[model samples]
Target: MQRRKYLKGMATAAGIVTVSSTGNAQVWDSDELSKGEEPKNPSPPRKGDSVMGLTDQIDTVNVGIIGLGNRGFSMTQLIDAMAPDKGVIKAICDIREKPVEEMSDWIKEEGKNDPPATYSGSKNSWRKLVQRDDLDLVFVFTPHQAHTPMAEYAMKKGKHVAVEVPAATTIQECWTLVDTAEKTQKQCVMLENVCYFDIEMWVLNMVRQGVFGDKLTYASGGYIHNLVAEYFFEAYWKDWRSKNHRKYKGDLYPTHGLGPIAFYMGINRGDRLEYIASQESPETQLTERAKELPEDHWAHGADDWANGDTTRSEILTEQDRQIHLQFDVKTNRGYSRKNELAGVDAYHEGFPSQLAVDSEGHGFVDDATYDQYYEEYRHPLWVQMEEIAEEYGGHGGGDFLEIYRLFDAFNDGRPPDMDVYDAAAWSAVRPLSATSIEYGGIPVKFPDFTRGDWQNKRKLQVMDFDTI
Candidate 1:
């Protein structure tokens, strides 16, 4: 009612209690916000008929990978540099037989005349490499609760997928990855490599050329990287991310600060998020820094440590926009991904990165002018994938320009600019920020995985650089 009494009278005139873990001070009127729920993702036999758009091209693809430790053996060396042109690694799984014999000796030191068929035996040998018939796509670097049931069993066993990231962990596994990519129409994607970072696509091409004239409201990032001892031996596999930081509490690794601010806040396409509040920040050094390691370290015998080495969450959109994110993966911090963007005129307080504008009203935009706004708004897919994504070094080339613009938007047939409704609304910010920080932070709402087709969809246009 009356915008929740004008946001609780502007947080009680600044005493600032916008609800953050406490007795969750009721408030949510309007019949519980009209019983929210429309952000899509929830059909599967709402009668098979599922297809959404585009999705069909192939042209040599063939790939298949399923966790050979660390992002499916670095995406099988990006399909061994796209197997002598284009694609083909055909198969490779890993219940771990020494990373399936070191990815079969890197496919015989990349001399593949047609090699790759390995599968470290059952744990559902990636269901026989996604029922391959000479594959087409399957990727899925497993273990995020096995990304939406292994990408809904490789798009219902017809292939074409691409897991990793909170591709699905709830929101009913993101509506079972949107009813199995719409009843097997295929194409899944969600490997959200920081929405193909290149200075966050030049702050999303300077807010799509308006140069932040106003309205793009807010966004602030943070995956404050400090994976203490980098990746704690990937929580010794069977222990998966330290038993999900001892069974979640909040933002347990939100998609690299919620995927480049949900791709510059184009959210599903028009804007969605709606509600979500979170808090956390207390649970000092994950189990006292895992008892200072060395118990033959396999996450040094994990114990109760329900996340929040620092959580932050906060988001709301349906046009009013606003965001916050941040989730410090147990810190001593070093890698910062905090890129803020709050426009009315301009604002960008990111990791030592700044930007002010409104004609420098109060001034502040200088980190030596970020290479002059990266040579004036680069992003033509970083001028053709920054020399092959800085030779495949994740992030500084966002995992090879998010796998070559997701396999050139799936071999040019389109439909894959991160789909399945942006992987269930950006992996439903880790189970709605752990049920709004265990009901004490309040306001959760968010679903519209684009059922109403994101009010006209089509924006966030990455890659179309004159047909590459």
Candidate 2:
């Protein structure tokens, strides 16, 4: 693929152009557009308005999901169950042939005669899938490194793309993905499953409704895990987690922790990310253990590739709010997926082992508060999520919800809840935080992925499944 000279003004191609309004005039460029022109009729408002009074688009979006690995396969199944009536999986691609065949077989077993066409080969095979005229959206589920390139190619090919978490691994890649999405005028959603979790959504609603009252001095976002036993170390692809282990030694996978917090805190929305300073534990357990093992062992003699056990990034939002973001992939101790939000009036917490919300005077309480809360504010569409989970379950019903929203956005012609800017903001933390680590844990400024207009942009369209 020829790397086009980076254009300064807006990019235009194939009648699909990104126009940015600086001052009172609109400037345009065509370097990124497939054909150096703007689409004659760029996505217009849908015709028939729905009960939610949202857009009236009803096109059946044809999807092609690339990199059918574990997450991709789960997303495919979720899409199959969630939006069967709204969209169809037209194609699936992966570097490995086994996953493609497995997904095809699964589709057939589900009684769908016209299973999505399967393609496998090099990393670039994704380009072919995205370019297909039949595909409206492309899901890139490959490793972190491949995300930006695939998304760039997909958007240029006139296909919307939804990539897995940690959208890009470098600051440059993050800006490129965001820039290309805007340049191509195509949707680029980051599939952050945790954002769609039931508990997280409930908390968001509560926060929005002022149930949390003025959030102040919050401690949220943490990842406590022992992933050394995972197949990531032994995979045939030599997963980037194993390959580039040394380079990204701090908060390498911060999205899992940062996603929900950013949403709740309104980062890039009501609040903007300012700067973050990170600190990693001096030594890693994996490195010490690896040194004790024989040289031939999978992890042995790989001390140079080991990252610190714990990385804590302190983020300061433009709102003057503080966030304690923690990412750890070492140790088999306590299992925790932290999502604790502290506020002036109230607080909510969610670790993998438990969930809790507290008011200042109330002190520690039981889980019944959350249960009652869920019962009261639960969206009617949420029940459908359970049904979909029964049909295809993964990641505690999160995988299904992610795909459900993807298809829902496509059919409704609205930006997804986690759109391009959201993807860039959430995932960019990985690289920015890494930069902080490289600079002796100094503060790193997060580049605004939206280039400063995300605030004026409409709130992402959350699927209103109530009427469906």
Instruction: Report lDDT per candidate.
Output: 0.71, 0.66
Superposed Cα RMSD, model 2: 10.9
Q: For model 1, how does the per-residue alpha-carbon lDDT over 1-468 read when each residue is reduced to its tens digit?
A: 554553554343212222221112234443433444122222234334434455677766778888887667776686567665567787788887788888888788778537788887679888887897888888888788888888888778788888888887777778777776777778787787877777777877787776677577788777887775554665453547767777777776677777778777777676767677787877767677678888886667565678867888888777767788878867786778788887777777666667776564868765567677767877777776688778867758678767876676667776667777777777777777777777667666676655666776574547345555
The per-prediction tally of clashing pairs is 6, 10
Query: Largest TM-score belongs to which candidate?
Result: 2
Weakest 10 consecutive residues of candidate 2 by summed lDDT: 16-25
- Model 2 CA lDDT for position 427: 71
Native-structure RMSD, model 1: 21.6
Candidate 1: the clashing residue pairs are 38-448, 39-447, 39-448, 39-449, 40-448, 40-449
Q: Write the per-residue lDDT of candidate 2 for residues 222-312, one digit (tens) a residue.
A: 7787776552346631676666556556677777778878777777666777667777786566566667766676677555654677889
